[model samples]
Target chain A: MLLFLLAAAVAVAASLAVVLGRNPMHSVLLLIVSFAALAALYIGLDAPFAAVVQIIIYAGAIMVLFLFVVMLLNAHREDEGTGGAALGGRPLAAGAALAIVLAAELAWAVLRTRRAGGSWMGAGPESDGTALQSVRTLGGVLYSEYSLAFEVTSLLIIVAMVGAVVLARRES
Target chain B: MSSVSTIGQALNGIVPVMCVTLAGIACMLAEAFRRRGERMPIGGLGLVGLAGAGASAVLLWGRRAGCLGVAEADDFGLFVQLVLVGIGVLTIVFSSDAVEREGLPAGEYYALTMFALAGMMLMAVATDLLVIFLALEVFSLALYAMTGLRRRVYASAEGAFKYFILGGFSSAFFLYGVAFAFGLSGSTHLDRLAAHVQAHAPAGGLLLLVAMGLLLAGFAFKVAAVPFHMWTPDAYESAPTVVTGFMSTAVKAAAFAAFIRVFLHALGPLRADWLPVVWVLAICTMILGSVVGVVQVNLKRMLAYSSIAHGGYLLVALASGDEVGRAAILFYLVVYAVTNVGAFAVIALLDSREAPMQTLDDYRGLWHRSPFMSGMLAVFLLSLGGFPPFAGFVAKWYVFTAAVRADQYALAIVGVLTSVVSVFFYLRIIVMMYMTDKAAEAAPAALPRVPKPAAAALWLSVAALLYLGVLPTRVVEIAARAVASVL
Candidate 1:
């Protein structure tokens, strides 16, 4: 519960900073922090595989692309008022209210389940949804059952590469 | 079949696509090897690949094979594959002069076109939603670059940028829908999705409805159906004329093929929930396409609207969801591909760097200068306008009749009325060509000298359109049988 609370707090704060920040670079940094916090939450939930992927992909690769686009778009200015105050604070208030309602609903569900106290989450002989094992099975199924989609993804990448060259290459 | 290994099964199912893909790779290599200004027949190489794929598709007809249970080489897919190959070949045939005239990089252009065709083939055959999405990305990426190939042209870059942004957003919506569907049902394969949906139905889940809505929105954007069609006119108008032709015909064919398989075959049991939505979409597409089309002066934008209206007619057939509707769709695709590609090829010839010749005023006196080209353009325009003894008339007649037979009277009446309304624009072009009144006084637009390959493509398309229009019986039966196999 403590870990969940810490991760939730960090995620909420970082995401709020992402939207409310005056500078695009600051927003990007806050978005990265939010992703990192989400990854930590995933790890806390026993999904270390997803947590690692979230770090490697979202926080690493996609963030790098975002940084590149930001720099390319705003090379002349270090900090500009891109997401300025025209986006009023009203939406944030409504958003906070919705978030509180969602949290309250979650608490209600948990309390109701506790009152009805069953062994639905009982420690039993069944698999406990091991993340590592699930990832391995996913790999196996992707290679065997979904090899078609896997191969075609390679084709998509090639097309993307060709497209990048076509769009960006300098003529002699 | 039981004894067949997975590799062999995949090999059997993917032969047609493999042919085209191999050709794409070859074109890339050929482009790399050629010296500057070396006129190696790169486009010819593309045609050979498309023809090989076409031959393989014909051989695969009536012999459905599943590629690892993901892609299917069914007659329906093969039929669409044949149409895409035809579109690819004709586009390549008409592309050389445009490529040369623009001083564009030949290798990239031909290679990208071949890759786009290969992707379209994959989309037609893919039975898994995952594979379909990949195919969608493959073609979308290639076409985006193809649209922006003229890097210096501002409109080209602008169009590609708008298309890419919107295309990426729509793809996200589609991916979200797929994720939701996989969560609701345990698989992304259409066959498995059908089973799961069947198991959960009449008490349909909200999540499922949301999934269908997202998926339909993605397809509607792709087919340029109204409300989601904001990108079509600019993209079509700005793309090189040959690329526009190929994109409009081949892209729409592949998209409709996948759309039919998903909505009609997989989510068919949920038709009650989705039919009214499609009905409204059809009505809007027909009304808006025709209404907005009448005001366009640029030929490409006008054709773009016309294509949107044609897409509505196909959606009308889709809404019908009957045997005749299925056959009508196949027939209409063939006719539409031939006529639209031919029309765009004429546009290509009339276009030059010094003079784009896109405006209606530029077409005046075209007949006096080049009788043959003007005659060909007139034929295409007449065909597009749905004149009797032309392919468009037969296609529209088939579609509306099928729609009416399925009790889609409103769709039929609307479709016919729009077709009549659309005739004005088509005739406007023909009148520009045939009037000869303003031939001397109009702008001295320098039409590109008729390239041999383009003329050949025009003749061939004209022949195909006439064949389909006059003798619709043989092809109609064949289309019926092919679609029946899937059902």
Candidate 2:
């Protein structure tokens, strides 16, 4: 319980910092910290495979790409003149109101589930006897049960590749 | 041995999609090996593939096959697949001239079209949300590229960028909804989701509603229902006219197919919950589409709004949630696809490199230049306005009847009123074509000659529409049977 609370707090704080940071580089680094906190939460939920993937794929690889883009674009700190002032009027107020309403509704749902003696969190793989977190089991399921989707994903990738070539290639 | 047999069975359900995918691959190979300045009939390859897909889809009818528990080859899917194949064949036929005239990359154009057709076919048959999402992305990516095929045109690039960004947001929303569905039911298959809904009726209340709302929003974006329709006009106007036709017709047909299957078949027990929401959407879409369409001077934007209105009519049919409504959707899709594609083909034929004729003013005195083309456009526009003796009238009639049958009297009334209001814009275009004359000094060079293939395709579309409008009973019966298989 203590670990869950600690990881959740870290995640919340880091996510807020990522959004609120002035500098693009600081934002990217804060996002990595937020991703690490999410991995820790995944570990607390007994999903070691998910936690490791969260760390490797999101925190390590995607964040590096984000950093590269930031540097390449030469992005700087948010301009004080346009940063908050641009969204300072009615749109901002409406956006905040909508966000608050959405958050409250989500909180109510979680509380309702808890009050009804239902776990808001998902069941661990041990309860299902499937070892779902293991890469081998995931592969087995992907091949056997969801094989059509797996194959279709290959088609999707081919289309993306073709599209990239079509859009990015220099015309002769 | 059992696994091998299972694989063979799974393959049987997807032969049509495979044919198109293979054709796409072949087109790519041919492009790579082509001489620098050689002209290839790559579009012919697409037609051959579509023919094979049509044949396979016909064979799969009544078989009731399942592919790896994710896609099903029911008569409903086969019917939509036949429509998609027809759309693909016509698009390829019409694109041949447009490709050369506009200097488009012919190989990439036909290949991307085939891939998009394949994705559309998969979406029609997919029974699993995950497969549906993948299929959606496959086609959307291909279309975004196709929209920007005119690399030198700033408008094309801008449209593609807007569509891609908005499309990504919708896909994320859809995936989030799928996640919520999985979390609630522990499965992504429609049958399993239906079973879960049945087992936990009142228990899955708020979360279930959220899932449905999110899914509906995703579909509404794809179908261009009002309030989520900001992307349609710009995207439609900026794309090559033929592409605009394909997007308006085939994409809507595939998306509607999945929407019907997921909502009417899977979450059917909660019809009462979603009916009111769809009801409101239908009304708003009808009103906004018709009203905004009146002020547009650009023909493409006008037709874009018209297509959104047509989507509204389809949503009215969907909200009915009855057998008649389901069958009406199939019949309406067939008629609308033929008529809309014909109209866009005319616009494409009139367009040239030096004078890309698109605005309402450009269409003025078109009858004096080419009587046949103007007459064809008149017919298509009249049909779109739901005139009798044309396919669109019958389609709208059936849709409104479905609403009336479901006791949605207000929806039917609004539908009828909007059809009347929307006819004004269609007639305005017709007036520009025949009634008004181009000023002596303002007349441009002589119009380009209509190519034989495109003219033939237009004739086919017109004939089909007249036949369906006059004698809709046979097709209506077929549509009924198709809906019966799934619903």
Candidate 3:
């Protein structure tokens, strides 16, 4: 329960920082922190597959979503002005948020080890034999029953690439 | 490990989707080589792909094979595949004009349509939650890109951005729901989930209900149903006309096919809980779509709402738990697909960059300028209004009959009343076209020239609407037969 509370607090604080940050760059960075906290929460809840997906897809893939847009926006960063001096309290808010997240992350680590009588590398308290098997079964099914779907995902990505090129092509 | 004899049959199941995917790659490669001045028949390449897919679907009909336990090559998927192919063919035909007039990149447009169609087909056949979500993203990404294909139009860019974000949000909900379902049942396959749900109901009911709601929200957004339908009009209005037609029909058809597969099959045991929620959704969608559609002056935006109401009618069929309701969905999909595509084709033919005749006023006195197209438009509009001797009338009748059979009298009553109210909006276009005077808001160029292929497609749709209306028995039989293997 204490582990849950700590991870939850970190997640909520980091998520708040993500929305409250004035700079898009800062917001993107904070979003990653929030996602990582959520993944830890999932691991605490004994859903390791979901935790891995949370890190890989939600954090990794979605970060690409924001990062690409931020890069696009970076080209016009000099043209667009930042929040003025009237909005100067951002760092105080950001620092408070990060401090809360750091404190909770440390608390979670302490609480998690206490429960499992194990270190961070140990299997989570509630997890048994099947937790590790979930990823293997997922892979087995993905290759055997859903290999066509896997192949199609590649095609779908190619189509997305073609579409992006077509839509963004400015010259004749 | 399976025998080679069974392998041959399972391979047949993948053939249709393979045809479409290969053709899409061809179009992409062709686009890279073609010179600027060269006029390539890129749309023709897409048509060939759609035709090949259609033929393969016919060959695979009633096969009832499962491809590696991930997809079912049943009558249900094949029937929907044919409908998608038809929609793809018509959209390509209609796109010929839009491609030339709008200076749309032909190779990109045709390739994207084929890819989207392939995704829709994949969605229809997929029997697993993860595959469905991936298939959902496949088409969603392509359509999002197509939505912004109008690069110069700022609103198009805005619509695409809004669609992308909302679509991504909905997919997340869908994925989370799938995760919950897997968490609950320890399996991602619908058959396994269904067996688990059936065996252990009255326990963890609330969690199941929440999962169902999440899944429904994702599909409702795809089908453009009420409350979840905020993005429909903007996206439809700003997209290229042919694309709007393709998505408004094919996306909904594909999504509905998957929706039926999940709700009516996997969650069949939980109907007592999910039905009332979907019932309320159906009634609100029908009411709101028709009433707001009446107020829209823009043709594309108006049709967007009309399509929303049509989705509600299909939802009503879904809410009514009976074989008739199941059959009604297939029939409605076909008739609705034909009429809506035809209607949008007329709008596409009459539009150009300078004089984009998008408004209701723009259609005024259209009969005087192009009698052929005006008459065609009249037929499509009348069909949309549920006029008899038109396919929409037959489609709406079957939907209401299913609702009545399930004792959903209130939904049936509301459906009939809203369809009548919807006629007011449909006639609003008719009044502008044949009834209103010529000079009210005449543009400098009276009618945008209709290309030969698009004109042929419109006439073919008119014929289809008439055929389905006059002798719906054959098509109705096919629709009925399509639902039998799955349910």
Candidate 4:
């Protein structure tokens, strides 16, 4: 648990460093670290399926696309002018908002935990066997109790597919 | 696995989407198989597919709720789906000429459009957070690609890049919010979340608020509200005019549909906590969107700002959070969609080539060049400006009245003030059209003939605007019932 917390903190700091870093490529690498950390957090939350999916889809696929595009576009921070530092002033505003959010989250966590009295019961002990079993159960519930969502998910994939094609078509 | 038992139920929910997916595939095949010398099958198959989707949406209306693992279907989802499908049809009709002019492959354009429409329908009808996220990506990725469709134009490429980056960032925030909600409530279903929020009440505190706020920020960006609106102008201006038309209408509607669903259903009990945040968003969107529009020389950029204002007005209805408020949103969406599309169609016709004639100066002496087209543009613009005896005014009236009825009188006042402020920009174009003299060669060198199908869309939009504006009672009654049934 201590290792996980430390890793998560390191990941968040790396991500901030990436955003604040002067080099775009360095920032990209930092974002990858952030995504990796998020995946770990998802795993620790007992949603290994989501964690793996996040790594594959977001970290592996989407970020690669972003990198390819950024490199192909050959964008340089120098070309963009150091307009980013001025954005730092806005950071104070962002920090205030973040503080409020953190306060609210802390309060909710305390209250909900107090209300539940630390009940860590899973939905059912019978399904507490394996990650595979959890995935199977998730799929089962997704289709049986949540099939409408499944269909919508399929539709979403279709839209993304088409969106890619349409948006990428060559000009006449 | 629960696969076998739910297959039947799943198939039931899948048919409508399947029809579109199959049609898109068929269009691709036809495009590939066609003879080299022959014209591509542009209008027929794509139109038919969208038409079929629309028909199926109606056919499946009220059949049963919760066929598979989905939450359920109801009047609200059905109504929103109908609106989305209708906008899809309109977009295709309006784009027929514009696409051809730009030398875009009709097959890819039509397929993506159908796919995006399918995603939107899914989004409007979805009750699951996971499904919503997927649907968002489906449509957004499609839009991002479409924004960069004109690849040689560096501007389009830049705009697409911006949209993709920001869109991806927002999606991440949205996913984190969903994760928090699932962590807190143990289920991502709207009904379940509502129950949890109600049970927990004020004590649910920061976690729930964070979840809701993150979600709000995500939707605010999608809907192009003030602070999150940096991407709208550039993306809209750079994308093909037809793509912009579709994005502004169909995409905006889908986003708002999901927005209202989440707020009204999942987060209702925590209204007091989030209401102030939304109130500020509403005011900023209205003020900035309207005031900023006045300075835009580029017509597309101007319309982009106006869209932000429209989003603000919709926010007012959402913040009001009443049956009437909900109904007002639905009605306003329909009217706004029609009027905005009509305006864009006119803009598309006013320009000759892929190069945009969007500057305010270019519109001078438009009245003398094409009387009918200019007049049509006037009607649509007037409606958008909230001018009376036109649909825009009536839609505004309904939304403001709904706000007042909900005891959100201050919001109503702000809305009205913004509407009046917005008129200046809308009239700026009208005055340029009618009052100014045609500067030598100020008008477009040549006006393309308004194709019959495109004309039909414009006429329909104008007729709907006037019809709904004059007699909103029937539509309002229907909208009210639709919203009430969902709640």
Candidate 5:
């Protein structure tokens, strides 16, 4: 539980760094840290498969692509450095809105004792509703009940594959 | 006999999905075999496939009412399918000219479109979280590739990269949420989750709320809601105008349809829990979408923000959690789709080699240069602004009424105010065309001839907008039936 809290804090902090950092490369790196910490939270939720996949696909592959673009485009230096933050004052306002949301949620947690009335102090079942077992269970459900949706998913992947090839290839 | 029956049942269950898949494959094969400069035939074949899917959807509609499967095919899904297929048809019409100009592989374009449409259709019917994730990625991947089709243009390629990266990030959040929901609910089937939610209603846990929040974030990105909407303007600005038209309408429709299904069915029991969250989103989306759009000089970027705001309006309808609200969303979606695509179709036609001409300054004195184009554009812009006797006005009326009906009067009032704010931007274009003389000489002089197919699409869009505006009762009735049938 403490580890989960620590990871959440780190993720939150890293997210702030990613948004507030002036350097594009630094922002990208902070995003990677945030992704890793999120993976830890996924693991804490008992979704090992998802945790592993998140780390591998998101932290490893996707973030590398972002870093690659940052490097390749050399956008880090040319990102209109000083005025980028001032392009809109909305982000700071968005942060305040998010804080309000958090406060509202916290207040609801404190006031609401209608049924399973108690403090949310890790006092009950650790089942986060969708655990790793649920993922495995979903696989079974996808095969047996939603098999068609599964096949459609595969077809979509194939189409995406072909599309990427066609789009990226040079004119013949 | 039992095996045969089982196979038959399986095929029956998979028909809607199969329709799109088979059509996409046919388009792919046709593309492979087609020769150069004979791309028209390929485009025609792809349209035939999408039309067939639409026909199949019509054929199978209401026939699978109680049939057991991984997903359900009801009137709601069929409505979404029809809308998506219609968009696909319009997309071809809109892209034909642009495709010719760019010298793209027509085969790939048609095939990717079909594939994306298929994913969208699947999303509408998907009853499982994993299926939803997969379907979302399917469309997202196709869009990423399509956005980069003009690879020689550095901005286009960069836009694709940004969309791809951000899309992957959001997909990860979706999957994580799915994991959390599965952990808490002990299942991923939306129906089963609903049942579980009801069983544990009073015993609500942070786990369910967290799962819901994550899922919301994922969809927030998909719908391009504020905060998660950072990628939209860049992407829309950089992509080909025709592609932008298709993406803005088709993708938004599919994502929002899935969103409605998940929230209304799976989380229906948790209405009290999520309603407030959605309320805030709705307000933020509307205000930001309208206000920011006014400041954008770039036409595509302005429209992108407009799309974000529209998504918020739809969210407001969804937040209402009433039968009237659901039906209003569908009605509003249809109206919005026609007006938006019509607007884009005109914009696509106006582009030239020297510059894209998407800025308001470039549009100055457009009426003097090409009356027919500017006139059509004025109608679309007015419709977008919710002017009287136009579809946008009716759509907004329905949505806001739904909000009022649900007792979210504050939201409804805010919706009205933001809508008023939105009018300024929509009118800005009109004002540029009529009132300004800033670029009268600079504006292109000759109006272009409309291709037969594109003309059909444009006319149909205008007709639909007019028909829906003047007499929306019938469509509203159908929308009500569709929503009720699903619920």
Candidate 6:
């Protein structure tokens, strides 16, 4: 419980900093921190595979790409005075209201699940508490049951690569 | 030996897609090895592959084969596969001239097109949500690149950017819906989902509804149904005309194939909950598509809206939710694909780098400039307007009949009314082509001759439209049998 709270708090704080940071570089770095905290939360929920993927993909590879893009674009601190007043006047209020409503709905759902004693944290038929996060089981299922999708994902990636080359290549 | 035989069975289900993929690879290799500025008949290679796919699909008809539990080559899927192959062949044929005219890289153009067609064919046949999503991404990525293939053109880039961002957003929505569905039923297979829904009808409740709605949003975006169709006009308008034809028809056909399977087959039990929502969507799409289309002057943009309204018609068929409705969808997809591709092929043939003709005024007195081109365009336009003795009329007639048979009078009425409104725009184009005199000062110095291949394809498409219109019973029976295999 304590670990969960700690990870959750760190995630929330880092995410808030990510949104609030003026410098684009600082925001990206903060997002990595938020992603790490989320990974920790995932670990607390007994999803080690998801947690590892979250750290590797989101915090490591994706963040590096983000940093490269930020550097390439030479992004700087956002100007606060440009359109702040106009955005904050009505749209901000409505956005905040909607956010509050969404948060409330999420909280109510979680509370209801807790009251019902439902295992909202990976307690389905396949969970079994142990083998759920095992890479061996995952590989077996992926190769046997989900092989078609796994193979097709390779085709999807090839298409994406070809598309990138097509769109980004010089017109010589 | 048994394992090998099982593998062979799996391979059998995907032979058509594999043929196309191999051709795409061959195109890539040819592109890499070719000398700079050396013209290659890459489109011919694509045609061979498409022909192979079509032949294989014909062979696979009525087989109902499954691949590794995720993909299936059911008759319904094979029928759509044949249509996609036809669209691909026509696109490649039409693109033979446009490729050089527009200075598009031939290898990338044909390769990407082959890959996109393969992905579309896979989408039609996939029985698992994850596979469908992957297939969607494959084609969508290829299409986004194709849309921006003219990298120097600002509108092309802008349109591609909008399509990519919006397409990514919809894909995320689709993945989310898949997750929700998995959460509810603990499986993503269509048959499993159907069984789960059958067992837990009305009990899965809100989450099931949310899943259905999200999935519908993804498909609606692909089909360019209203409220999710903001990206259609811009993307269609900016893409190379031949590409616009391919995506507008093939994508919708593939997406509709999956949409019908998922919504009306797997989630059919929850029809009471979803039917009213689809009814609302169908009405809105028809009204908005026709009304907004009436104001568009750009030929491609006008067709984009017309496609959206056609999507509305398909949605009406979906709402009807019967075997007749399913069969109507199959028939309509074929008719719409041939006719729309033929129309866009005309636009491509008429377009010249020096004189880029796209506007309504550009079409004025086109009959005087090139009588054959004008005549072909008139046939396409009249067919689009759902005139008698054309494919579009029969397609729309089947859709309306399906709706009426299902007791969806309001949807049928709205569909008929909006189609009537849409016909005005189609006729407006035909009128401009035939009636208005070309201003002497604005006359093009020289109109490009229609490439022989494109001209031949146009003639074939027109012949098809006439055949389907005048003697529709045979194809209608085949379509009915196709849907029967699935339902």
TM-score of B chain for each model?
0.97, 0.98, 0.97, 0.95, 0.96, 0.98
Clashing pairs in 2: none
Provide the TM-score for each candidate, comma-separated.
0.84, 0.84, 0.84, 0.79, 0.78, 0.84
Across residues A17-61, which tens digit of lDDT does each residue of candidate 5 receive?
987787889998999899999989877756677887898799997
Model 3 interface DockQ: 0.46
Please give the range of 10 consecutive residues that has the lowest summed lDDT in model 2 chain A: A123-132
Worst 10 residues of 1 chain B by lDDT: B436-445
Candidate 2 local lDDT, residue B25:
86
Point out the higher-scoring one by DockQ: 1 or 2. Answer: 1
Instruction: Tally clashing residue pairs in candidate 1.
Output: 0
What DockQ results do all the predictions give, each relative to the true complex? Answer: 0.62, 0.58, 0.46, 0.39, 0.37, 0.62
User: How well is each residue in A1-172 modelled by candidate 2, as lDDT tens digits?
Assistant: 6888888899999989988889989999999999999998887777777888999899997998898788768887767777766867887888799999999999998999889888887543344423344767777898988888888888888888888788877878
Predicted candidate 6 versus true structure: per-residue lDDT over B255-283, tens digit per residue: 99999889888998889888888898899
- Candidate 4 versus truth, CA RMSD in Å, comes to 10.2
Where does model 3 exceed 4 Å of error?
A: A1-67, A75-138, B1-10, B202-204, B440-443
* CAPRI grade of model 1: medium
Per-residue accuracy of model 6 over A1-172 as CA lDDT, tens digit each: 6877888889899989977777888999889988988988887767888988999798998998999788767877766675457466687788789999999999998889889878765433344567354966887998989988888888887888888888878878
Candidate 3 local lDDT, B1-487, one digit each (tens): 5688787666666678889988998998898899878988988888888889999889888777667678887999999999999999999888887887887788888898989999999898889998888888889999999999988788999999899899999999898889889888988899999998999774647788788889988888898888899999989998988899889999989999999999999998888888888998999999999999999999999999999999999999999868889999999999999998888888888888777789988787878888998899899999999998999999999999999999999999999999999999899888887888885543457567787877887888998999999999898888888898788
List where candidate 1 sits over 4 angstroms from the true fold.
A1-48, A51-56, A63-67, A70-131, B1-6, B438-446
lDDT of 1 at B205: 89
Q: Candidate 4, chain A: TM-score? A: 0.59
Alpha carbon lDDT of residue A107, candidate 3? 90
What global local distance difference test value does model 1 have?
0.87
* Per-residue accuracy of model 1 over B260-368 as CA lDDT, tens digit each: 9999988988999999999999999998999899999998999999999989998998999898899999999999999999989888877887876788877876787
Candidate 6, B118: how far from true, in Å? 1.3
